[model samples]
Target: MRIARLDTPAGPRHAVALGDRWHVIASPFAAPLVYTGDSIPADEAVLLASVDPRVVVGIGHNQPGHPLPMQAWHKSVHSVAGSGDDIYAVRDVGTVNIEGELAVVIGTSATNLTLENAFEAVLGYTVANDVTNVDQCPIDQRNFQGKSGKNYTPLGPWIETELADPENVATEVVINGAVVANSGSFNLPSSVAATLVYVTKWLTLEPGDVVLTGAPGTDLPVQPGDTVDITLAGIGTLSNTIA
Candidate 1:
């Protein structure tokens, strides 16, 4: 089932998309209930980030071309941004930037999970815009600090449970109507299973936690008023406006 969070007249509510309309799942945006009948067309609804995870983990340099030591993964951290929020261009910082990537949601508690059992931990998949401010530090440090700007991580459109091989899907980013970053999951240096294993070794992943697989190529910079479209192969697209 495809699940999403949306701003409704009542308030923020969880919903499931079916055909051209959405079924209210949960109410009050906290714990939702599935509402059947009376569908609302997807286009008319204001889609919000699928969830506000307690922890929003990110992978650094996980792509093939930017391979780094596993220990360097400490630089990876949790980041968050609201849907349709403005991402600032840190002028004081040297070169602020943004990257688009595919994000995975944990369905169950994962502790020291093995590759064989990793899929069970996965709840669904979504699109993410991992915005960074790269100008102030060295290339290595850039991945650490610049990547975790407040309200810099935008995720959702919705979560899809039936993503054909979530670990090996295609992801792309469009800026102002132009494709900027495009790559296949095959380009990743570490498999999703490996990442889960490595991450769970230090942190216990909860049901709502999210992990953004690293971007594949050079970063893109967005100024105020620019729209970023992040798309995943099986999952839907997440569009956010930069301010």
Candidate 2:
């Protein structure tokens, strides 16, 4: 099942994709999914960001390169934008980079969630493009400077509630109509389950919080007016224009 956040007359509403249509839900933020009985034509309902994550957690360099999840940081939740939205450049730091990542949506709050049950906290999966300002600062504060810029991450289309194989999901990044990166979510230095369990041991992962499972492949360069699309095989595409 795929869930989405839609733009309604009332406001942004949570919904579920049902074939060619979508039905409003009470709150996907709650588990097992609940519908509000209101429905609409899926194509007509404008899409917003799939999930409004409370906090965006990034696990940097967690792949097979350096030992441990080398670099971790917090991206401002305001950085979250939807597909079709514009990613503006920070005036002084004009360079931009795009990365494709698998985003995990947290469903339930947990503390010290054991590995044996870590997957239980996951609500679904989605695609994320970690947009970075490459005109970075010095080594010590670079990740902070480069990643914390406004509208620096674009996530969207929809959240896939039924991900068949979370471990080996494929990801792709296309810039200005060119495929610049291709990789899978498998065999990472740190697995999703492991990351979930580890992070929750200290932080309480409440519903709607998001954990970006790191970006894969090379970070491709993009410029103002360039279109960058990040797609996770089953989740759908997140496309944004650099402005």
Candidate 3:
């Protein structure tokens, strides 16, 4: 099922997609998927980030030929932004790169999980734009400053809870109406389950936490007034503009 969070006047609300409408539902992490019998037209609903992640984890430099299969980093929770929001450039860094990627949302707390059960902790999958400023510092430093900035990560449109074959999903990045990078899960060096296992060995991910699976292809830089669209097939597109 496709799930989304809406920005209602009352506050943020969880919703489920049914036909062409978004039916309000209870929190997916709290109780069963029960509809609240309230809904809005899918095209009319205002969206928020698919989940309110407390911790945003990133798997960087996981593309083929990287010495380390998994290079992890942390993005501040404040970096999270929803689709249709404007992302401003950090004043300290002149160059900002956009990395379109598939993000995993944690449904349950996970620690030292094995590959067999890694997916059990996953709530769903969503699209992510892992914004970065490589100029902030050397990548070897695991530059928290480089990766973590306000409104840096743009996630959503919605989450896909019923992904059958994640490895076969396609990911694309479009900048200013041009397709710059085209990739897919099949190009990933490690499976999502394996990345989870590797990460859980060191850190425990709690509910509502997010894991960015890593970006593919070369980094694409953006300036103010540039529009970016990242799409993960079977999920949906996440569009944002640089301000």
Off by over 4 Å in 1: 27-39, 62-68, 71-79, 139-145
For model 1, name the residue pairs that clash. 24-35, 25-33, 26-32, 26-33, 27-32, 94-135, 95-135
Q: What C-alpha lDDT do the candidate models reach, one value each?
A: 0.72, 0.81, 0.86
Cα lDDT tens digits for candidate 3, 1-243: 888999987789989999999989878786577887889898899999988998888886555776766778788888899999988778756688988888999999999999788989989999998888878767538668787777789889899998887767798889999999889877778887888988899999998899988776736898889999998899999999998
lDDT of 1 at 26: 46
Backbone clashes per model, in order? 7, 0, 0
* TM-scores for every candidate against the unseen true structure: 0.84, 0.92, 0.93
Q: 1 or 2: which has the higher TM-score?
A: 2
Best by lDDT: 3
Worst 10 residues of 3 by lDDT: 60-69
RMSD, one per candidate, in order? 3.7, 2.0, 1.9
